[model samples]
Target: MFRLAAAAACALALGLAAAPAPTSAAERLTLTSQYGPGKPQTLLWERFAEILERERPGAYDINIVTNGALGGEKEEAEAIRLGAITGAESTIANLTTWVPLGAVLDLPFVFQDAAHIERVLEGPLGDELKAAYRAEGFETPAFIIFGARHLLGKTPLTEPGDVDGLTMRVLQSDLHVALWRSLGANPTALPITEAYTALSNGVVDAMDMTKSGFEALKLYEVAPVLTETAHIWAVGVVYFDANFWAGLDADERALFQKASEEAAAYFNEIAAEEQEAALQRAMALGASRAAVDQELWRAAVAPFVEDFVRNMEDPRAVDALEMIQEAR
Candidate 1:
């Protein structure tokens, strides 16, 4: 009787000591962005990390890589595609490589304000774009507002005619190139990292960038004239590789989704404030600000829009343009 009891006790002790096969370590999630630490985007992601931890404790540990430490925008995007990186915050232009429909967001003068942009992106159009990203092996968690684009140049650009014959640096997007060319400028596509040198060396005379971007990059030091063209409102997308997203548990996924939505909204608010502050900083630094002649600029670039509509193979491009016009 005592032997059997001892055996039973041993079994019970072993069962208890086994510790339920030891729960696996949480999956690691890494998020990369070109912006430096302490930037609004980084702070937004930091909050996202807190949300993930609180909502899905022990399920995920998020690591944020900032300041292009992994790579510049394009390289970071390519890394996500190859699964070398799990997540990133990149411009719609970068996402266009996976989904051509993304280029639709870059249509110049499409959105007048943040509210208009929010309505379009948070509505059916945004959902459709998200679905397209899913089909392309990505999970677009949220789209963050990047604020309105402005013109920064060595020479004043009050109208489209002023842009003529000027070599302007543009994002490495075909649409951006087309837009600048349409305005009569010699557009050169370069990565944001190279833009500072390009402007300093006179390789490019002007560029269309966000006010915050201009201040952050210190481009105002080189380009003293900042024009409020407000041609297009830009957005940044936070996304994860589909394979990585799929590996996340239900609770983890929910956490990410919720966190992203909240972060995006917060980012929009911060972006607006930063844009105004950047403008003030630029002005303080001796940069001049001028109002652009929208009518003249529109007339000069009308041909380019017509050409794009006529020759562009992507039907979504036309649809997006029509949608923006209707919204206006």
Candidate 2:
């Protein structure tokens, strides 16, 4: 869905495309990713860059850094706040530290399906969350999704009790920890950069992440069983450094905002295709796919979801969750 020409179609060939070259005489800015070249998010960054190139010629040189070279999403976000880095994407769970309103998005089973997610996030509720993001020093221009997360392990983990006693690698979010803890897994908060070695060396028994993330990092090579939990929708923001945004002129900010909208919409349009393709690749590589019992999972997590909303430090999170459910 990108405007790149036929010859540039390789950009979406799953791991074949690199970010386009930086524009000429443009102010250098970093757009970091926890993935390498050819991944969808990397391509999202490339798409963002191309829009800037066409609309604000010679105004920005959005340098793409992949493979957690700038550390994980949390580090990248910290750097952005310090103005040490320009931008990166982060899940709503990861943003909970600064914006408790993110809790609404992280609730399990809140999103019924991809269409439900698109309707809620692309509608008024999303705009409210973006304003919350801005209040916390994150200039979120686009809401991108990383697909739903599933468990990856050496054996099928298709039920709530199946995860008992398993060591799972999770992002550095307390909510994520609580989610796993409630399911009886000992969750380790690790930066994604170490997931491969951790899983390879048996430091962890399994992990949960989006299929594209597992495929992009080749994590399926180590954890060959993917359980389709679809518990969380995994929405995130393609955000800018608040400090950088503060310095840009109104016209400049408008240009970049427009580009973010277009690129993110394109990203959403292709998210499913990318996930399905990534799952196929993982399966072809001798990985096993398992299905979760939907009723079982829903019942198991319903109480926690309720408690989570009730205890949210930011009262706005409850309102946001209500808005999402009402929209659904």
Candidate 3:
């Protein structure tokens, strides 16, 4: 019995020694988002993390903190730029606060359609934006096209005239405020986190948001009317801290590049599905929709677009618009 016990102990020790230990702890990177799980942007980050793990197993331990666990858009963008947090999913409107050239993309009707968007993203415009953002401590790896922004209201709101004299919830960007003001609305800049509550309490009568966000935040319940302005397609980026990016070696950078491209393609594909489903979900929840004469909205904003480009702080804003127009 003693001999058998000793033999068992020796065999167990040998087996443990034969097994290989883990190479090293995976590099920890945390990404922030204002959307929770099942939302498009949150899914985009999850897809990105999955691709990284697939390409280099055990090399990256990526954590996606959702529903603004880190902060809202403005705070998260600042965090990424400061390297206080590793990364975040952010919009061009948010970045325009830092890089004014980004406002070109925010112009109404800049993107004619999906194919036009594809041309611009695959063209020199993306490269230009990437370089510009890198100068501002953000290493923008991927460009994503989210759903278009539309007007939402508790009342049956439909045309450019409908928003006139209404208190509107605008993004935490001056550009959004200026755009809504041009339409004759009283624009008030507010973080998306406060949009629902503001709408609930009559602080704001109308607001603009993407289809997916309208559904994800259940703003459809508060503002039960959706006007499909399809004004500006929400172009967003996977922004990483430039310092964090600089610390990566060539091989690691290559993995990130590949992962970003794959994940972006994945996002654009499913985002359309999510947008369609969002409307259906909203309708089921007692929401109503109105069709807009898009050409009218386009005409209304044409002058504002021109003025916005002219007054932009960045000279390259003109060049950015030229690239997008050339692509079209």
Tell how far residue 290 is off in model 1, in angstroms.
1.6
Residue-level lDDT of model 3, residues 56-133, one tens digit each, is 888876667777655568877766665556888788888887888887888889888777887897778788889999
Candidates ranked by lDDT: 3, 2, 1
* Whole-model alpha-carbon lDDT for candidate 3: 0.82
lDDT scores in order: 0.78, 0.82, 0.82
User: What residue runs in model 3 are displaced by over 4 Å at the alpha carbon?
Assistant: 1-24
**Per-residue accuracy of model 1 over 1-328 as CA lDDT, tens digit each:** 6334444543453334332332568676667666777777787888888877777676765667676665567766666655666787778877676677777777776677888777778777788889988888788989988988889998678887788899999887778888888768999988788888999999999998898888888889999888988877787788888888888778768877899888877878888899989888878988878887777766766777667766666677677667766665
lDDT of 2 by residue, 1-328 (tens): 2212321332232123235665466687778777778777777889989988888678876678787776677767776776666788778788888887777887888888777887888788888888887887889988888899888999999989999999999978878899899999999989989999999999999999888877878888999989999888898888988879989999889988998888788777776678878888988988878998878998999999888888988777778888889877
* Per-model TM-score versus the true fold: 0.87, 0.90, 0.90
State, as a TM-score between 0 and 1, how close model 1 is to the true structure. 0.87
Which stretches of model 1 miss by more than 4 angstroms?
1-24
Worst lDDT window (10 residues) for model 3?
10-19
Ranking by TM-score: 2, 3, 1
